[model samples]
Target: MNQSELRELLSTEGLRLLDSLPAWHSSDEIVRTIAELRKAGHSPGLVAAVLSQSKLRAKAASKFGPFAERMLFTEAGLEQATRLSVAAQHAGRFSKAGVKWVADLGCGIGADALAIAALDLNVTAVERDETTAAIAAFNLAPWHNAQVVHGDAESADLAGIDGIYLDPARRDARVRLTNPADWTPSLDFAFGLAERYPTGIKLGPGIDRDLIPDNAEAQWVSVGREVVELGLWFGTVARPGIRRAALVIGDHGTAELTAAADSEDEAAGELGQYLYEPDGSVIRARLIGDLARQLNARMLDTSIAYFSADAAVATPFATCFEIVADFALDKRSLKKELASRKIGTLEIKKRGVDIDPATFRTSLSLKGENSATLILTRVGGKRRALLAQRTTFAETSAATA
Candidate 1:
């Protein structure tokens, strides 16, 4: 974006520019470019945001520098684009259901819209902000039948839309949340939209379960093995039950749901001969019971997320690990054993331990050959540690990137 066009974009539209300067190809080049852009009228924040997004896009090899120059890559837009993995996740749902038409509401930069369109879905994308709407339009230009409309979804006429999708904007250019209440159209309002058609609501993983309407089936999704987003599905496939599903794309794995009967059942402790830790997505979905049933695993502790089952079973739901050694906590002994192993990397995964792993590793001088996962926790109310490696079955058969 040239200085003249950029100044007109910001000054005439009452738009808040976030970042818009090219990344400093070199330190001196960046200083020179910023000086020139400022002289031509560009805010530092705007310059920074634009350059940051450009850098990120460059990293991803998205050759859209000319487009970035015009758009404001605010923290919110970057976060909505990068942090929220719901678009790809919702696309996965379509891949599972074989659906082809999707209505992407509040499409922002059209990241999700593009993803779904890539999967061959006819996308009807709507955005409210002229600047953001324009960016979304540009991002989705490659997809045929991608209709980018400028309007608020809360009042937009909804007709002939097959599958509904909404991503409520929560933050502004300053990176401050505009209104907590505006995080989304009310659930009541969303339900109204879903009542007319199948819908998916993209939400933060931290959203409370109580906020989820009973009419919708909520599923937490992880992409590339990380639990990154949560979604609530409303319509024909929506279940009136709490469920958790793990999607390991390119593999055939059963989607598991928590039975009503099981939901009412209290969790119990079952520290047995083996231990299983459900993938983050499974845990987020609250499908522990289904996972246990799938693997014949039982809970190791009522309050902990660990699961245990004796029989050998291979499921994408979790990584099964055989406990080879369990010992009491003794810093001296641990340091001695770990040092003797010549361990160089100490990967500490702890539960119920008050010690900081970094300090602990440093204190123990854990920098040699003992590069393994060290699990520290309280079992039977006693502080202890477990040394383990990926089980052969898990190492070979587990779903991992």
Candidate 2:
């Protein structure tokens, strides 16, 4: 959103109109709402801006929850903003460390700063974009201890601040930048702050492992099975004896696997009765072996992340599936077998395979009463398919414990 549009949205009348609008449903509804507002004598800019923000607020609900309803967001700022649940975890790190003041460098829309301020810590939220900085100021205005500044994070004075949280701009003109140096407030500069202050740097989960500092505690966080962000905790922010961690947050609550160093690879073995798919965070954090050892499992292949165990294991770090049938990697034969067994609903999961599950399922022409999951991956250097039944951790734990 531009400065003028943002100014209008923050106005008393504009905010009232925006709040009065119903939750966004479809494109037709938005068009109708826009027309109604325009016919009501609202200025074209105000109507357009309020309608756009209404749509964005609906979209932002998944990230910000109730706060999205009251906040202003730009397209780019909303895209880059951290999820509120995840931001709370970041804030917890500082609060637990007794940090009284923090500098949130490159803060977009002040999502992280909101969490930090909610923890009762003083926050200086800095954004380089003038428009985004203004929106951030509005979002953070409710917090008496928080202030938004329009300036370069690289030049922000960190004096007297107990900690620094840096989320560098990892995108350029809507495209995600893969190289660390390509990011605004580059990784080098963000990391340099570690030497002078307690710092936490947020990065993408797919960041190069070699680029991570040896002394820093690197963590990969996944929410609901998707790896979202990588957090690097430096100096006092780093947890003792934990250099690498995989933090998974889901319906089951938070589970963490930490190690002093990267976990070693487990030896590949024959397919067992149960197959396990490690959480994306564990794979990204390179802690699959640690999870494997916990579950008494072995890797399905030397290069793949899938694991096999002889018994039903209850672990939050992985999804366990009981093997019902194993077959050679042949589509026609597999289709015939599944058809013969009257298997209809299918969940096709793959790793180390080129087949697209949707296309492959269409080719199967499935029609049956039974439902099963199919895992397509290599086992002992050969492609194989395993028809399996998913077992929940709660169920398995109750039976096995």
| lDDT tens per residue, model 2, 315-338 | 778999999989998999999999
Cα misplacement distance, residue 168 of candidate 1 (Å): 1.5
C-alpha RMSD for every candidate: 6.2, 1.6
lDDT of each: 0.64, 0.91
- Model 2 segments more than 4 A misplaced: none
The model with the greatest TM-score is 2
Per residue, candidate 1 scores C-alpha lDDT tens digits across 1-401 of: 33443344455322343333334343446667667767868667666545555555543333232444443443345556633234566776655665667888888777778778878878888888776776677667778968788888787666766778887765554463544365545556777788877788877676766777666777776554566667778775454554444444313433344444223212555455566777777777666666776666666555666766666576666766666567788899988878877777877777777989888888888667546777787676677777766565545354332
- What's the lDDT of the predicted structure labeled candidate 2? 0.91
| Consecutive 10-residue window with the lowest summed lDDT within model 1 | 257-266
TM-score of each: 0.74, 0.96
Worst 10 residues of 2 by lDDT: 25-34
